[model samples]
Target: MSGWALRTEGLVKTFTLHLQGGARLPVLYGVDLSVASGECVALAGPSGAGKSTLMRCLYGNYGAEGGRILIRHRGETVDLTAADARLVREVRRETLGHVSQFLRVIPRVPSLDIVAEPLVARGMAPDAARAEARALLSRLNMPPALHALPPATFSGGEQQRVNLARGFAPGYPVLLLDEPTASLDAANRDVAVALIREAKAAGAAVVGIFHDTDVRDRVADRLFTVEPRPEASRSAA
Candidate 1:
C-alpha cells in the first residue's frame, strides 16, 4: 500500500556448479533496486549480466546469499530473503505474480485452464476465471480453436501468450516478467505492451526483463541496469 512496492539493498546471489566440483558462480552482487506501484522498472543488461537472476530473487524463486529483498504488502514490509517457504508461498499467492520466459505447466492441461488457475486459486468462481482467461487470450490474438487444447503443442509464441494471460489474470499487487515480448511479432508485441501499460495504470508494481527495446521504451517508467561484478570484487569475496 506504500509508494514503493518492492526494494532490495546490497542483494547477492551465487550459483554452485555441483556437477563441476562445486565451483561457485556469482550472478548478482550488491544489487540495489526498487519499484513503486503504478510504475514499471525494466531490467537492462547484456546477456549473463544477472537481470533475470535479480528478478527471480525478488519473486522468492532464488535465495539470496546476502542483503535484503523487502516487499510491502498490506501496509507491512516483509523480507523475502529471510522469509520461510510458507510465508513466501502466501506472499506469492496474494501479492506477487511472475511470468518466466518459459511456460512450465502440466503437460496435458488445456491452455484456458492453465490461465484460469491463478484466478480460481484466489477464490474467483471457476466459470468467471475461464471467462476472464478467454478474454485475455483473445486480446493476445490467440486462436479460439486452440483455447481448449494443451499448450504443450503450441508454438513458442503461442505458449508465451498463454503465459502472459496467466500472469496478468491475477492482477496482483506486484508482477515480475521475464522477456514478455521475446517471442511475439510486431502486432502481438504491441498488444503485450498495451497490457503492461494497463497493469501499470491499475497500480501494479512491475519489474521486468524486456530484451525488446521498443517494448521496454513504451512500457518502462525507468531502467535498472544489472552489471556484472568486477573480478577484483569476486576474488576478494
Candidate 2:
C-alpha cells in the first residue's frame, strides 16, 4: 500500500432547497484530495466555500452526489462513497475518527461515559475505556470532579475538551477535526496542538479546518484550498 491514507476523486455534493420550490444548491464538485499517513492537511477556503460540506462528505455524513471517497481500512482501501450504512459504521468504529466543532451526545450522560463510549464500542472493556478517558480528560484540564457530570451544562471550552478526549482516545488511523481548538484558551489550545502533533507522529492521517493561523501552521503539513464555484453556489430555481 502507498503512504496515502485517504483520498477523494471527483467528489461532488448538492443540497435541495425544499423551501425554494425544490431548487438545487451545489456545494462541492470535482474535488480531488489526497492525505498521507502521519500528515495533516488543512482545508483553507472562504466561509461559504463548502469546506465543512466537504468535510462532512468525506466522513460520509453527507452522501456525495458523485465520486469516490477512499480510505485505508484494515490494510485495504475502501470506498466510503460506495459503502453501505453498516460498512460506514464499521469504518468509523475501526478506522476513522472525527472531532466536530460541538459536542453532541445523549443528554445527561456523564462526560466520562460520553468519552469512553467509543472505546467500548471498539471492544475495549468499559473499565479500561473509562480509565483511558479519565487520563485524557485530565490532560485536557478537565477536572476529575466534572468527569462524573453531564457536559450539557459545561462551558464551551469544557465541552470541547470532552469531545477532544473522545475523538483522540480511539487511536484511529484517519482523523477529521473541524475547528478542534476554536473554543479553547491558550493553555488548552496548546494541549490540542500537542495532541494533533502526537497523533500525526503515531501515523494518524489528519484533515482539519483551522481558522487559527497559528494552530494551522503548527499542525498542517499543507493547505488544500476549497475554491467556491459560483455557478454551484447559486441555487437553481
Candidate 3:
C-alpha cells in the first residue's frame, strides 16, 4: 500500500552469443515487474529464463533495450533506466542493493570489509560500517571468529551469509537477489529466508529468483512465473 520502491515496464534484453556457426541468442523477452516498499516477490522459472539478466538490468549492471526502471525516494520517482551510469551507481550505493547468483568476494578483502564496502561507498565511517556489519553478521548467526578472515576461504553457507549481510548492510530501499539461496544447505537456507523477511520489515522492496518451491512460498507475498510463449509452446508441439 505504500509507495513502490522499484518497477520495470516492457523490459527487454538480448545477447548475441557468437556460436560456432555465428548464431545469436535472444535471451529476454519483454518483461515487466514491480515491487512496493516493504513487499517481497519471487520470480520462478526454468533455467535460461532471463531471471538473472533481469536482476542485472534492475541494478544497472546491464542495460535494457526497451523499458523503464523507476525507484521512488521521498516523494519523487527517479527513472533509473534513463539515468547515467554515475547516477545509477550513486543510487545503488545509497538506496539499492544486489546479491548475484555467483559469489564475488574480492580477493584479499577481509570478510568484515566485504560487508562494510557499500556503507563505506556511501560515506560512512570505518568504525560505523564495521559495527553495522558485525550486527548483520550476528543476526545471521555468523561466528565472531570468522569476521576477520577473507570470505574466499569460508564455507559456501558462510559465504552466502556474508553476501546476504553485504546486500542488507546498507539498508537499501530496493534489494535484488538472484538465486540467493542456491548455495546454502537446508539450515542456512532457512536463515536466508528469515533475513529476507527482515529486509522487507525494514522497508526494503525485495525481489528474488529461486527454484525452491518452499523458498518461493515462504518469502514471497506475491508470486510471478516465467513461462514460454504460446508461439514457442506451439512450435515445440
Best lDDT among the predictions, by candidate number: 2
- lDDT by residue for model 3 (11-87), tens: 76765546645444455566778799889988777776667777788888887777788887545788887898777
What TM-score number comes out for model 2? 0.97
Clashing residue pairs found in predicted model 2: none
Residue 58 displacement (Å), model 3: 1.2
Cα lDDT tens digits for candidate 2, 31-142:
9999999999999999989999999998999999999999999999899999999999999999999999999867889999999999999999999999999999999999
lDDT of 1 by residue, 2-22 (tens): 478999999989988899987
TM-score rank order: 2, 1, 3
Local distance difference test, candidate 1: 0.91
TM-scores, each model vs. reference:
0.96, 0.97, 0.88
Question: What are the clash counts of all predictions, listed in order?
Answer: 0, 0, 0
Report lDDT (Cα) of residue 126, candidate 3. Answer: 95
**Worst lDDT window (10 residues) for model 2?**
228-237
Instruction: Give Cα distance to truth, residue 157, candidate 3, Å.
Output: 1.4
